[model samples]
Target: MSTPTSTAAGTGQFSQRRGIRLGYQMPNFSHAASPRALFGSVIAQARAAEAAGFDAAFVMDHFYQLPGIGAATEPMLEAYTALGALATATERIQLSTLVTGNTYRNPAMLAKTVTTLDVISGGRAVLGIGAGWFELEHDAYGYEFGTFTQRFERLEEALQIIQPMLRGEHPSFEGEWYRTREALNEPRVRDDLPIMLGGGGERKTFALAARFADHLNIICNASDIPRKLDALHQRCAEIGRDPKTLETSFLVFGFIDADGDRARGLQRDLIERTEVEPQLDRHFVGDPDDVAEQIQRRVLDHGIDGVIVNMVGNGHEPGALESAGKALGPLVHRG
Candidate 1:
């Protein structure tokens, strides 16, 4: 296997090779019939995604099912553990969390965890992290739910410790939130494990992405994409970094079926069940072709680099991801 090498300053091999243009995010596991069948279904989706030409597969890093998607009691797998299992079950597709909550683990430990995953996946791990926003998980897990500024500060410090460790260096850092003394991460497969930041906070997140991220998965409303892109550019510019060096993608909620009506119906049912207004701007609801068109017009047309979609309604169905991959692979790869 080829060892990973560093790319451009803010970019990593993942984005440099455009390996995340069309990603499959598995955020719902309740589709499985039982606990024993859950992981089989997960493997099936990952295989379907890889066979259908998706470049990456992601799982949400949450202890419980997130609100608006399902009740808190729904089944939720540990992200890194799932990814480690996935690395053995699949080949060629990158594995990661859509965004790991920074508060959930110690920074150096997180670094070692991802490095081990890189070795297991033969260097196909991307550290997708953010200043974790889900307060419920924090509360339930007994992790501190700090102020917004404090969370960002912790995330920054985490990155400071993580970056060096990923490259096989012992880093000693002291911060108000976290401190590491010559922490070591060993048994690495490659030096340049890519990092992806997920969120749309133009002030803090964008600045951090400019400084630390290899890719930015912008999580915002569709209409806000252009403005967000502009803000991201400004952040990069402020750091004297070229904006193009930091690749970007959008996270979209998908309700897709071959039958467009069925897809829309699913979307409607989700709204009714959750009793929360759908952020339609962040959703793609239709058949494969229709969703592809929506993504092209709203996402790719806005200068975003890629798309990571979670098909909450029917992604686990045998051919659901295959159909989506057939339609979307060409669209994002065209970039």
Candidate 2:
């Protein structure tokens, strides 16, 4: 098992690769569902996703819905709290945020929170973190929204403390953005809880992933996948780490429906509503077959480790999760 997760295992750097697996991100608490039913809707979608053969499920870690998805006032649940509840609701599917914004919490507290999640979920937690990018959230919540360089620096310090703690070791580090005095995460469920680092910063992110992360989920223009993979490989090699040991995946925006026409219609409406040009490079808009084929050709063929798709439209509706999985599950498993 590639560390049995993207977050755990070993002393220095990750040394193994988990086989490719599929995942879904439930990102629709603010759209079709009533405000009162937000968390329930999230739980239901997560349950449906697991039943439909998704290997993992995720939600965004943010105080506000992202600009393209909804307004800031849209219902956005706290990530760990929702995941803690999901632990009781699920038996097999891995649970995590697509990527946790590091600035939202203190590094030590974040490590402890993830450790608690690991214990609660029976070792089903993954630390998917990134140099937080949502400036609006930071400004809104009174977090120090620093420059890009500063955020990456903070993230590096965070991992120094977080990774060792995940492995049941206490680490002390003092840096410009953070300082830890022998901080530790106790009662760790497992020493090797996989750590996944998300984003596509070629210099900062890939290097950090090489040194600290077991998985790297690339978030970028779809046309950039191959180049990004090459860059990641180089980052691993530069640090004398094996590239294969760092599993990889891409975030796909999927607009799925019963048929192509319906899917495209939904897609067009979303485009009109958002008033933004569609980013269809790694995105899929069609029936199961269309989505699956695009995933196979664009993602797997590029040697990505996995595919994590987000059904942007109609995901909360009945039969959507199962039907989409029926088409995409085979491809995800084959990876």
Query: Which structure among the candidates has the greatest TM-score?
Result: 1
Q: Candidate 2 lDDT, tens digit per residue, 1-335? A: 01112232333645243333789897767664566767777778889999999888998898887767656777788899999999988887888888999989887898899889878888888888999998988888899998999899888778877888777776776666666666767888677788889999999999999999888899988789889999998998987888878889999889888888999887777667663466767568888888888888888888886888888778888899999889988876762
What is the Cα-based lDDT of residue 32 in candidate 1? 81
True lDDT of residue 313, candidate 2 = 79
What is the TM-score of each predicted model, taking all chains together?
Answer: 0.94, 0.93
TM accuracy, model 2: 0.93
Clashing pairs in 1: none
Top lDDT hit = 1
- Candidate 1 per-residue C-alpha lDDT over 46-79 given as tens digits, one digit per residue, 9 for 90 to 100: 9999999998999999998877887889999999
Q: Scored by CA lDDT, what does every candidate get?
A: 0.88, 0.82
RMSD of each: 5.0, 4.7
Q: Clash totals for all models, in order?
A: 0, 11
